[model samples]
Target: MNKILLYFLLFVGIQSFSQELNCNLVINAQQTGNENFQVFTTLEKQLTEFVNNTTWTNKVFKPQERINCSMVITITNKSGDLYNGSIQVQSTRPVFGSTYSTPVYNVNDKNFSFRYQEFQNMVFNPNQFQSNLISVIAFHVYMILGVDADTFALKGGEAYFQQARTIVNYSQQEGFSGWKLEDGLQTRFALIETIQSQTYKEYRQVLYDYHREGMDQMYEDVKTAKKNVADAIIELEPMNNRRPNSYLMRTFFDAKADEIEQVFSDGPSVEITKLTSVLNKIAPIHAGKWRSIKF
Candidate 1:
């Protein structure tokens, strides 16, 4: 009976802590007129297994606690084993005391090019650069984890972001488009660098305040929550003044424009004249969305 009880406890423990990300990965190869659909299908199946099965962090998360995310890789061209494509990554977190899941990270990476063979094993090694495919996917995974953590706690995503930075460092020597500083202003290097820089510290703080302190409290006290959310947006104005039209700022609004519009469109009513103005100045491209916000 003692041995049986010990085995049962072990089983329970194993079941309790599972993989962190519940990612839905899709491989779209319609643009590649290759009649060999089997390769793409197999690649999708293996990648989906790799992403969903790999344990991303030291912290243990229950099944339901897993971060909800999606990755769509659109293969634009194929030449034998070489593939050129783009990847769209998006992640969301559930709001406290509510059924709604709020978008946290959403961006499209256009520099995804890699070599792959059908049924090739996809493995991730953080300490070393394995392949462009692995490094790119792992980098985005950490970014998703980092942003999600920031929403829950102030600077909570530091460790995850560092992991992403490590991947960037290791990948730079491989001459990939998104891994180096000269790749472009909006490359993966820039995204991680800007997020970790002390100059843009307020961005992380806004994430915590906007989500944990504001969105999480909506079900309990909506008026106070709206104010908190608005204050978080206002906090970005100083940062915007210092660094206008930043890549990070654009990335933030890309994931949040619709949600921000909806948040102020209908609520207990908080003063948003300044809020809309600040948003327009910082993110002029989103002015149309801001205009739709009801006063």
Candidate 2:
């Protein structure tokens, strides 16, 4: 009897140790604009509702007491344009410490969920930073839009621009790190400036001509190709449903397209490439350095 009682006491002690304080965390719905406010308020409200109203783990301990928990909520208003969401009470309490461990989970970007290939043609037309991500963007657009590539292309224009602008702004601020927007922008800027620096201005003329005349056909061809790509991807959707999130079929198709396009791989003029290379070399120093220049 004493042994059983001892075991019971130990079980009760463990239960007591694990007992969580039930607390109400209220976040003003209007405070959604404030970054900190958004995160914390959403967390508290969602977690409270999740824990208090419903039972998560069905297996109960000997004494049948609720587990003690601590929660934190965070809200970021700056990111409100991109995401509006709440963090649920994301924690589990063992018979232990007071500190609540917050495991972070990312919100899925709407861009990622959309047809990416169609999204690309719209953003990359001017060959800006958005052009740098043409391949990946095309792949995503194809995957998400599936059969509705043309419709997705038409509707996704604004979203593609917004997302592209965001990425470009961020990369520029961060100094063109890695293969992101900053690097692409810097490369384009160097190419343009090198042409502009010449005494003859032939390079500049070529660029102007390329922009005005050459780009129209290029745009039409690329757009048409993208539409075809979208159609191809839509055909692959049944395969995705079969495999779920597998890009193998889409990638194979894209690779084939790229191989075909490689026929036009002959690059810009030797003089232009040389001057651009020089500009890019010195670009690092001039990237962040700004002095008042008289126009």
Best by lDDT: 1
Candidate 2 accuracy as TM-score: 0.20
Using TM-score as the measure, the top candidate is: 1
Error of 1 at 121 (Å): 1.3
lDDT for 25 in candidate 1 is: 97
Which residue ranges in model 1 land beyond 4 Å of their true spot?
1-19
TM per candidate comes to 0.92, 0.20
- Give the lDDT of residue 12 in candidate 1: 16
Q: List the global CA lDDT of all models.
A: 0.86, 0.28
- Residues 1-295 of candidate 1 have per-residue lDDT tens digits of 1221122121112121123799999999989877368999899889999998998898867788788899999999999899999999999887776657788999899989999998888889989998999999999999999998888878888999999999999999997799888899888999999999988989999999998888777766777888999999999998898899999999999999988988888756789989998999999999999999896
Worst 10 residues of 1 by lDDT: 8-17
